[model samples]
Target chain A: MIPDDRKYTQEHEWVQVEGDAGVVGVTDHAASELGDIVYVDLPDVGAEFSAGDSVGSIESVKAVADLYIPVSGEIIEINEALDGDPALVNNSPMDDGWMFKVRLADPGELETLLDAAGYEDLLGK
Target chain B: MSDLKQTPLHQWHIDHGARMVEFAGFAMPVQYEGVLAEHATVRDAVGLFDITHMGEVFVEGPGAGAWLSGLITNSIIKGEPGKVTYTAMCNEQGGTLDDMLIYRLTEERWLVVMNASNHDKIVDWMQRHLPAEGVTMDDASDRTGLIAVQGPDSQDLVGRLEALAPHVAPIAELGFYTHIAVDGPGGEWIVSRTGYTGEHGYEIYLPAGAMLAAWEELLARGEDLGVRPIGLAARDTLRFEACYCLYGHELSEDWTPLEAGIGWAVKLKKKAGFIGRDALAAQKEAGIPRTLIGLEVEGGPIAREGCPVLAGDREVGHVTSGTFAPTLQKKLALALVEKDFAEADLMVEVRGKRLATRHRALPFLAARVKGDPRAERALS
Candidate 1:
């Protein structure tokens, strides 16, 4: 199910804004399609990225996909638990699987993100 | 997509929520539940595979052994009945046409199991040279269903098949590379103590009509042993860890068996005058220019197939089969490299960046082949 609260990207990442910081993670569909999450690669905290930049990557047994930053921001904190238990991304992509927290560089970039209905329409679901 | 083939267990896979993908013209399961979980299940316990997508061809005649000996690199004439020999069929230029397992069913009969993608190629290659008065080849792929039950506890699961209980002795005592014909729900099938994964396992080739029953029975009986259906994704990783060559990836028409690390299987001294004997023997005398070596990357970015292998500033080779091995927990790859550059301590270009790598030995993990003299006593 596409959650209504967060903004979604065509790349399948979900972003939720809390004050000036945004929490980011992949969508449920992305996690399901990748099959067992074997490894997750994230950039170091304090790293700045432009909107749609390849911030990191996630690898499963059969495939690998580059993780895109949904909006331009500077990474503040990353979920360190994922280093040992990458399966958390598959188990709870929307919540505990959140990859990192970033302080927004420009709140205007969120306007380009898709709403829940738009994301569902993009999936044709 | 319309011409894509479906195996007998196609619907069964879909019903189990398998994510399907087009592989060699068949809609096969890439993963089910998850690839990591399925891989771990096979490594630690037992797992089943629907390998009906593989091709099975039979040759039978008075001259079957002698005729096959001429077409393959292995000495098939010396292999007795019920024994299996892994060999590579090569072109006159010594490039591999396909690597297959040949089972001598009897003095006049033989079964050749080949990769699905090379089924037509192998058939045409054999037919062109088949002795007119002797050997006859028949394609049994459509009627055959191959199921691999692999892991340490696979033997116990096979013993519980009620319909197959009477034939338990062969299953219990079957040596590696040996097979036995058993009467079962499928009328009759060959149970071979052979597997692609490095684990101790059995591959059952039976009638497609009776595949479902066998699959269900294996799952039902293997429940306590944690037997689950494994997908192709894990199958590749498992075989990769074992350093098994995948046709299009590692073994190919452009590479010879000598360079692919199967030189031991090439019997050039045999007097049968095999297909590529002259070329392989000539290469042997001159020494193979390239050799296949295993590589382990430091971390994250995987070195996939076709990735260039670097020796300082010069690109010396390319990766063939690579993966993040589930059991070993390392990003490993098999690369065909210049003989001089195959030594330990190398690097690979992954995603435009060079990653530090080390040349590990083949079969990253110790193989648990049943009859290997050096194999540890434990089944795993």
Candidate 2:
């Protein structure tokens, strides 16, 4: 829900950069709509990706949704903890529930995304 | 699109964060807190369900007593004033008209609860049997709202409410399949000591006007005490775990009780004939062609309805009800197969993958009763 501290994709994914690495995950609103997060699919570590591409998919108990990458980059690491506990996405989508980390392909491309305030407005919040 | 029905609690469910979905021709809450959590909570503590969409029919008058006896498969007149009997309305051929519960309130009066989708069909069927100017059939579904409180602690939870205090009686005295008329918050109602979930619980049949207050009362007291508002998702899983047969799943226009494993409800010995009595009796003598059985699957990852039941390479049957049985922690399914193959060793094809499964006697989750057969078969 912290719209200002992070950048958002049109797909409702949020990306927060820490130094040179970008942490990617879904927003709280997305998880709330999906209900229980029974399964999470993440890209393999060291997988190369470009901007505006689907990274993987997420499956709730009732429905399935594809996860799109907000900022194009190489997936440097995946959150292994979610393999056992998918509810973390529902409980704490921002902190311990981050889905993956990526090294930015072009840091300048980040400017194309919406800042926290803009994302909030896009959500009518 | 506007024809689907909505219960009195429909708006309340939406207001309380319930995800609504269309089911059985009624818009019902599919889940509120999530299916797994609600399912677990009901098994451990308590959960409340709005089951107002279920149909209710009142049979009364001169031969209203024995007329229903001839129509239904259970002994409706023999029960105590408050006692309830889970029975089926079957055709002469034993094909199920509808599986229902008969609440015997008096010698000449009884209330039958039926499935929502089959309400009209059951009513039409009952009218066909109405004695010549002697009995009357009244559809009370429009005026009633039923709420069920289920789980290990449900009895204690429901008994604690000030509004429900008058209905409270000795816990042991209220046996299974019984009901009573108490000074409930909404007025006189046939509060039946019955529930679809295999736990010890009560189903309150009260006036629709009092539904909101009664719901708020249960939910208010149930807050944070592990009593949750369950939805259709939890309802299906809970009933499936209890091996309770659903209307469209186990019994349908084409299927019969002998095949559905509910032959005990048919009173063939009564010497009176029902719609399908002769057909059922013939099936009994000739042996059923197919039998419904429970399958406990390993590594199938929650078998669901329509998963094919495979006998080696042949597709013999398919699952009618299936889920990752919350209590058993294993994928369980109910399926109809040839009578000979409905045995211990069986396999099911789920998602084009053949998986090994075992035929376990139904009611996978044991209701904590003194001499429950499920208790003895519990996988410890």
> Best-fitting candidate, measured by DockQ?
1
Candidate 2 yields a Cα-based lDDT of 0.79
Tens-digit lDDT track for model 2 on A5-102? 77888788889988898899999888888777766768889998888787777766555688988887889989998977778999988778899999
- What is the alpha-carbon lDDT of model 1 when measured against the actual structure? 0.88
lDDT of 1 by residue, B1-380 (tens): 55889988888999999888888888888888777788889888899999998999999999889889889998878778989999999999899999999999989999999999999899999989988887889999999999999888888888888866888887888899989886777677999999988888899999999998889989999899999999999999989888888999989888799999998889998886888889998988998999999888876578889999998888899999888888888888899999988884678997788899876877787777755423453211
Q: How far out, in Å, is residue B142 in model 2? A: 1.0
Each model's lDDT comes to 0.88, 0.79
Where model 2 places Cα greater than 4 Å from the true spot, the runs are A2-30, A39-83, A86-89, A92-125, B1-4, B161-164, B170-172, B221-225, B344-346, B369-380
